[model samples]
Target chain A: MDRVRVVGRRILCGILLSAWVLLPASGWGAPLAPLPAPKAQKPAQAELGRRLFFDPRMSGDGGISCATCHMPAKGWGDGQALSAGYPGSKYFRNAQTLLNAAYNKRVFWDGRLSGADLPTLVRDHLTEAHFMLVDGRLFPERLKQVPAYVKMFKEAYGGEPSFGGSLKAISAFLHTIASRNVPFDKFLKGDKKAISAEAQKGLALFRGKAGCAACHNGALLSDGGFHALGVPENEQIFQDPLRHITFRRFNKVIGVPNFMNLRADPGLYVVTKEEGDRGKFRTPTLREVAKTAPYMHNGALATLEDVVAFYDKGGGSGPNKSPRLKPLGLSADERNALVAFLKSLSGEAVSAKEPKIPDYEIRKLGDN
Target chain B: MDRVRVVGRRILCGILLSAWVLLPASGWGAPLAPLPAPKAQKPAQAELGRRLFFDPRMSGDGGISCATCHMPAKGWGDGQALSAGYPGSKYFRNAQTLLNAAYNKRVFWDGRLSGADLPTLVRDHLTEAHFMLVDGRLFPERLKQVPAYVKMFKEAYGGEPSFGGSLKAISAFLHTIASRNVPFDKFLKGDKKAISAEAQKGLALFRGKAGCAACHNGALLSDGGFHALGVPENEQIFQDPLRHITFRRFNKVIGVPNFMNLRADPGLYVVTKEEGDRGKFRTPTLREVAKTAPYMHNGALATLEDVVAFYDKGGGSGPNKSPRLKPLGLSADERNALVAFLKSLSGEAVSAKEPKIPDYEIRKLGDN
Candidate 1:
């Protein structure tokens, strides 16, 4: 039985290898290059952050960890339409992919915070009511009780366990995650046939006919700008009271007018607090597009085809929908090609194994 | 300034000594005998338990520790009428003293659990909604994250950090606590000069006129029985919505009928679930009576004088008020003597300094 299983796997691999496209090495003419490598991080700090990224104890209930949402296996995005929030609460937004996040100048769907300040982003996620719900004052003490964290903090920051130090350590670890070798990068580096012919046609449509390049044209395929794409709302927000409560609470805390009755998410308005910014969300990076699914601020589109179709039909209705969104009237073939090109942007799975969480101990008879 | 302060203190002490009572050395007539010493505990386990007792991180929010309400300086009980509960909630009952807890046959205000199995008691206090509110499933992981707790658990219970082990460790520490040297105990040991003549007169009334010994008897000055003394309700339960919610929730979860509208504590009915048990409560130990002020289940009485006066006028109205409660018709002089005798039951403060809580560390890089 084992021999048969091994032979079966080898035969499947053989077929896949033959089916795999081999690009012409000499003629390189890709439109974009790979993202610039993320800044190098301190080994000790990064190491500590890597462990903390998976540690659930930092949460209010010790049941939710950073990795619980930003899972490495699922393109650093939980494969859910909306985040399965911390215990007893529900979230209203889709989990965003964290891959190549190091290159982002701005972070979060609304771009309210700077990517350079990764610690702040981490703090927001960990302490936000619908997320980890951690109390800032009490979390450090949670770390203090664990002897292993004390030594790690001392080694990484030359200090004891501290809230700021932990965040910075996690930020340092973020620097280690970025887009790796992909066919698009290979094509940019003078390899003519890295992507298939159909993908090439789709790429042209992206730049020309579809006008996707207007906002998604950089190496990360993002302008880092907010736009009102008019993505439809996910009905689950209003249907589930837990989700509705979370939505209203977020809006209320951000001083949104009539937060109790606002049925739709304010998106970028959360930051600008301006009516013009309503429904506008940051243009997200397209890297690792294939691995992350149920895409958009509210995860309104389930597939790349659905996203293309939405744009082909001039987008959904919103208070401040962008004028740039016009009917594309693309043929069925053109639609498939666009999705194919989008898929080409993704590389192999980038992941790390979860570390062993250490147990607490009595330090000594005298020292607690 | 220092010399004058010292001289002033010495003069005050001199005046107090002359005013203090002195008893006859030969007469040895006391109503009750001294309490037996608490059972010996394993040193390593007891030491571990002692430190765990002070570690606030064991709580749900890391803001309430075992020592938070059971303060050593205040007779192992917080000097508040109602306990300052875990964050985000309010307690409805008076903080019970931990002193002589090891000697009790039953525990909790309702005597719902066995004192011999202290882990059960600790579990209730730690995880109960209005108390610590700790999630048992997550707390073990919290302990696992702390390196110090890892070692302590191993030292105490020869295992990894576990929910049951942690509770047991806290229980082990409880065993170390008990009443210490008191005047009444000294007098029972045949030292007649240990207590004052006024205290002696009060002792006679305790076993006779006042009928106090009918219930407040034995080593711990408790009958290990339940009774309905008709203690009035603490108004805070009705005044503070936070406390009221906690009360309603506690009752609701305990399967109490008509819990939401039941403004008064159900007392022993919480355990027996019988109507006859309404307003009945377990007799609390009076070993450290002097330090633990604001007495009774709801802390309706602020001083020993008030308690004496209450019993002197029979007890308050309750569904099942004890028939034993009757008017004492004692004079003001008799009230003072009774109060003095109650004071003799107390001893020097039993306390341990808070241990240095350890900081967490990053263990080996590969081991989280």
Candidate 2:
């Protein structure tokens, strides 16, 4: 029985390999380049940032952390259509993957912030009411009370615990989160058999007929530019009253004219306040795309196939839809190949040892 | 400057150690025995259970898992006063630590079930609407749909996915969660310096004047019996209307007479429907007790110090208050020693590698 099973497995493998090789290889383009190694960060600074990132005490309710949404096990993005916010809230947009985020010139879906420095982003996220909801002034004092945090701050920054030092340390840690040397990278580095033949065909389609490289270009596979792709509205948002209120108030505060009139997300228009920027979202990198699902800004597309089909139809109709989006007349095989290529982009799984949080002992006044 | 810093650190360490040793050893008693290792489990069965434990797809929403609330990192509890239920829901009760739970004859604070076998507990937790909210019948079908799970199920149980098989596999995994060899255990095993002298004084008080051994006895430091300790009501439950409704309905369904009139938690009363059983909760094991806070069924106590103080006051006045309750007259030093001893119950940390969840591809009709 064992011999028969082994023979059967070999036959199956042979059939699958032959089928891949038999596919027409026309329209193949030059292989994409590998991602470059990120600059090394100080070990002490990165270590401190890691602990801070996982510490829920930094949040208002002390129940959420940076790792909650950007969990390393889930491709640095919680595999959800929308990120769960503080106990009573939900994010208006899908949680973006943190992989290769350092390569982006701007952060977040709407490209509201121009600087991608870790410290600036950490500070923004820490104090953002929509995120951690921690008061910046009080947060430092809270950390100062914990002896372990105080020690870490002094070691990482050569000073007492402060908001600026915390952000800088956390940023340094974020810089160390770069993923490199994926199978796609090996294929790009002249290893013809690094990825499956199906992936090779998909790579060809991505760069050529599919026109993915028009926006998804460069080592990170994103131009870091915003464009209106006319992605459809996620009706799920209407069911959540808190999310609806937050979305409306956010757009209004950002000076989005006629924000109430918008049937769907105004996207970049909320940041830029330009009518042409309406519904435009920053292009996302495709690194580790296979692990992150429920795609798009609102997570409207459930799968890569759905996303490809949407693009194949030149996206949904909108006033500011990018002209670059046109019907991609790709065959079924080509579409599957494209997905296979994208799957190859996944690198080695990243995991971090959870840091030991210090226990705070309640001391009587003047005891210490 | 460096030499001065080193001298200051040594002085601080000396002061802390000397303070511990200076505590009176008058109440010191015989040390407790170390906890024994759990029986070996079949590797294949446990491996299958580990995978299922971490697979969020097992839940109704395909989001929550056993590990969601019983996170290994936080001592098999989420380190919350109340466990977060399905995305929008909050549990009325705190998540219990699974460490050394196998030693119990009854499960849960209410002691609703007498059986301690893993499968029974797994089934109860899985179908509990306030917990995973997963329908047993549908859950098996969900697992069956996943090819990888089906293969694992077959290997582990020699059958396709079934409700019984899934429960057994998950139970097998739970059996592997036993924690032993804590510092207290090492001290009990004749390692005099395994725990601090303060902890030694605390252990003596626990076994003698503190009267903790009356309930918290045996290898697991729990008598596997119910006791009404008059734990305070968690007001947080009142803030959640759903929790209030669920609590009422659960008590009513269990035939609790005048459940509404009961102050705080009815606890074991709901299960027995005996008026005398009112407010009685099963004694929880002290294994990894330091990691699992706020203490008690309602999670009203915020710290171990608060828990010790509560006991020192001989518990609150209530109908079913244990007759064993009496003021221990423990001094400040004794209280600190007891807290230190409790902290020493924390064993080596346990962590499970996250299993890779297989993606479910939407196939055309009859494609499989």
Best by lDDT: 1
How would the docking of model 1 be graded?
A: incorrect
lDDT of 1: 0.78
Prediction RMSDs, each to the true structure: 21.3, 24.0
lDDT score, candidate 2: 0.73
Q: Candidate 1 versus the native: TM-score?
A: 0.53
Worst 10 residues of 2 chain B by lDDT: B22-31
Return the lDDT, model 2, position B44.
Answer: 78
Q: Model 2 over residues A7-74: C-alpha lDDT tens digits?
A: 57645644544422322223322123556565467899989989998987666445678998889888
A-chain TM-score of every model:
0.89, 0.88
Per-prediction TM-score, chain B alone: 0.88, 0.87
Residue A222 of model 2: what lDDT? 77
Which candidate number maximizes TM-score? 1
Candidate 1: which stretches are off by over 4 Å?
Answer: A1-31, A365-368, B1-368
